[model samples]
Target: MIALSRKHRTALAMIGFLCLMTGSGCDYRKEFQFSGPTMGTTYHITIKAPFWNSMTSLDRSIREELAAVNKSMSVYDKESEISRFNAIEDTRQSMEISERFAEVLSLSKQVWDLTEGAFDPTVFPLVRIWGFYTGNENGLPDEKTLEAIHHQVGFGYVRFDDRNHIGKCIPEISLDLGAIAKGYGVDQIAAVIRKAGYTDFLVEIGGEVVASGRKASDQPWRIGINYPDPAAPLDLVYKSLTLQNKAIATSGDYRNFRQIGGKRYAHIIDPRTGSPIDNGVVSVSVIADTCALADGLATGLMVMGHEKGIALVEGLPGTECLYLVKNAEGALQEFASSGFGKTP
Candidate 1:
């Protein structure tokens, strides 16, 4: 989940009740809530059912589904499909991949094209250069070093044959699916819940969320967007929306960042610049049909800034975005796409 500062946590607590309210009256539909750790964070799943059996079975199924996803995409796992592929040095041979991996790669390519390469997954080397990969905040790299590594990064270096589920990449190029994998995992868990005949549900991984059907109270699932102020408490909610059968993902520069000298470097690096973005836009929230798309787009919009991000979202169908920008005078300015404020 997006880590918030102490002040932001307090703000979040203040607004928590407004975002989700359980039905106080007795109802036939019972609510089940459970959570566990996954993907270096945690996941929360809530379901409303008229009749159910064995929470143990349900939890086991959910964990198994999520574990499969992690085994496919996690960079930290040396035995993961992606990590194993990264270890290969031959660019001439095409490698077979799991269906899930192929699906994510295809979607990532679409996002790469849509955002004009602002959302490339092949920039992991740049991430490492900035010390984001190891959590060590080293100073910036020299121009020559950046240029040399720049040759090794680019989505164009990757080729995917969807018909055969095969992937090919230049020897030096590798992928990091950190941005979209968690959201995809959330969607997969939501699928598991729906398959079990439960439609009224909410699945959240870290901060990425997907809401299905409605609450037992017949109210739409409500989600709160955190304020884009690092100094604010995590409980501080800038806006709240009711959504059903949709997914929401947010990307912000406030939480994950490194401070060097008088300047701060956000975790999100601009693939185009081969460096961390210093754009005025502080946070981006995207609502889409799938959490994976929302997660990828949110990161893309943050790199694109306000004007182009708004334009890109407006042209797309079944999508909306909210942009929070820190202005010159330190005031936060809000901008939303045409459909962002509409009732779902």
Candidate 2:
């Protein structure tokens, strides 16, 4: 339920357009950029290809890929596959879903289990009750109200099978893929670019990014993690990584929060406690082989806090995390996995 300011959206939309229109070309390769709005945010893509490669066809294919993802996953779309399923009221009946929908759901389940319910798409009810969802009143709910809603929140209520049929055990249970869909969109577009025989490209949706091969300058792609300081400039970099053939997704509480009763509540809710996360951990960034995994894990890690988060990541091969936490004295501190800043 995090809201993006109009200013942030406009800045993202302009970045790729300016890069593409200016014809920023090097001696051996030309970098082509494409950008537009999607999934409640903007996406920017840059491809380093030979001078002869046609951006026209690639642009068409990339847009098609994004459209397909939005059609399947966007909750805002009343006619989307997810919305249609959410409309169903019968627990005994199951609806057949597209393969792409099943793919994202399967990944969601894995992250849900791995994080021990730290991340649950079924937490939509709690999100609504906390007034994080649009059109809801923002206030602390009574204990009775919180208890009633907790009964409706759990991934166990979601029923699905290998045949791509999905149903909820209760009519009130619903799914929201906001935490992971953008990363999945990035992965899908990266696949599209690879299918077009392009080896060097970077795909970014919102702040989730995936890098493939080196840039036209023969250097690894440099990605900056946003500094989780509300007072600082929006594009300020806390850390930079040179990435190749990897994905990074960051989730932070600094930007998305509601001030109520003279205290701030983060948009991220703990499905287990049926409450907004108030832990001092302010930001989490995950690096993984796939952006979808990174995206889900980032949110889950934020809920897990620092100690357990670091321990959980240490066991996950090819997965690393960086956590920015606030000490009791109100100072920013950093905790990272063993291989967090290492070049992959």
Candidate 3:
């Protein structure tokens, strides 16, 4: 489901996230650039190096590989394998799904189970009902209407068999991959890049960013975290860290929701309630070994809110999160996992 960001009267903003050039102390710099189309969105890559020039051919390979990934995963595309399966579930005795597709759904189930229905694919029905997937160009839904959608949302309904690459949809149920598919696709593309002997690189899909290696400039890449305020320049550097074999993802409901009836509602919905989240969190950023984990987990955190989400992140090794939310005083409060604050 696509998120619908709510605009509030309060002047608080935490906006966009960017993957930047890698290096150290603003001096070291590397020249690595790779950008190609996939997933109905262009993927941009920047790598620093002699390695960059050495692997120029890799740019084309990376793009081509990611395109293949999109074919199997995109629920939005009617011709996509997943989309076709969604359309034809009852017509055939069995539904054919791809190995990669099965893997993503399988991983999604894990998050669904771990979070106890927080990150659910079955919430697609609720998403469609609210018109986030279609009709209503405007954002936010009436509370009574959204709460009714809660009946159709559940993660346990999506059934798949990885061994045979088959998936079946329960009646009246739809699947939404807006939260995790992009990251999973990025991970697949990254795997292809590393397999082809490219080491130092960065990859971004619709603002989900991951990078590795140092820039020729010798400084860690500086990522600019946007403040939602339109008037404010993106001067605040939220992080200066090397991707250096790590993946990072940031998820926020602020970017996509709309204001309604003087209340602020997040595009991120609570599957159990089938309503837009009221979790005061502005954004949740995650760091992990793979973009897939970081991506799915970020969505999970969005659906989980602050306290429960932080508890979840704290218990997972190598998983750190920074949550931005409105405090009791209405001033912004930043809560970071132990692994996050040390970034230069």
Candidate 4:
């Protein structure tokens, strides 16, 4: 597996990719396994039967799409499309972008509006200043530094046109897709798999998981919600959830963290405050109808904490979250909403 640290912080991943052989009821079978990088983490997807033969196509094309996404969205990358937009009079403001851009921008706006600017993409300056980005790590910025970037933050400062497929920023502001792009990638691959005429498979791009249909054994999709701990072994998973025709995404402050000057800092940043939200929560797992919704909710709930986050999920038309909070004794606690009761 290709291991990459998160702004939130991270560890090695031991993922399994399994494909069933075809015989009688299924005449052919194949299995290909590899660790694919995503969401600043490494993930493995096992395509079975017909797809095993086309593993190269899936790997090459998926990596390219992810690269394109990073180029267009990662604020840490200077030459990326989003970075370039914040560079200056980005003249290509009205030009057509890839389909992924359109979908992501729309989702970004929705979450930003819904959260009342809590989920802004333009908070990169603040994020970077607080050491959540590439430059700093577990180092708190002075008030002056925080103030300097605060003005450059806020989703309201960014502008885009969906009909014309264009985007623009205040030049000083940047976009970070750390919260949403992986789900979009999963959605893209799901669309691709559907196009490929595969009916039974599971696609998880960096924990933004989407399970299309049942396995050949008529079993529901099984997903594990990890127990977060930076000081312990990563492969030691403490929980697992099963789903069929569902999306499971987890946002936590566990893996991605830094300790400097005896202070522990997680990578999950609060856009409004330019710091991490120390909700007693370890991780937030959400199950929803759409991967995009689950991804956004996971991020939002991670910041909103347990009480408000659970309230938000309860009020939503169809959304569910399991809040894994850490107690004073360094133990994990669980909280779920009525919406979670509907999840299977």
Who wins the lDDT comparison?
A: 2
Predicted candidate 2 versus true structure: per-residue lDDT over 1-344, tens digit per residue: 22347875576556657777887642546788999999999999999975545588879999998999999999999999999988989999899999999999999999999999999988988887888767665578889999999999999899999999999899988899999999999999999999888889999999999999988888899999998978879999999988899999999989877888898888899999999898899999999999999999999999999899999999999999999999889899999999998975
Relative to the unseen true structure, what is the C-alpha lDDT of residue 228 in candidate 1, on a scale of 0 to 100?
84
Candidate topping TM-score: 2
Overall lDDT per candidate, in order of appearance: 0.87, 0.91, 0.69, 0.69
Ranking by TM-score: 2, 1, 3, 4
After superposing candidate 2, which stretches have Cα over 4 Å from the reference? 1-26, 135-138
Which digits, one per residue and each the tens of the lDDT, describe model 1 over residues 1-344?
A: 22457876676554555455753444546678889999999999999874323467778899999999999999999999899888878777677889899889988988999999999998889888887858765688889999999889998988778563444567888888988899899989998998777789999999999999999888889999998878889979999999889999999989878888888888888999998998888899999999999999999999999899999999989999999998888888999999996885
Residue 153's C-alpha lDDT in candidate 3?
Answer: 66
What digit string (tens of lDDT, one per residue) describes model 3 on residues 185-216? 77877787677655666778876777766555
The Cα error of candidate 1 at residue 330, in Å, is 1.2
**Candidate 2 CA-lDDT value:** 0.91
Candidate 4 local lDDT, 11-43, one digit each (tens): 111111112332224323344454667657765
The positional error of residue 248 in candidate 1, measured at the CA in angstroms, is 0.3
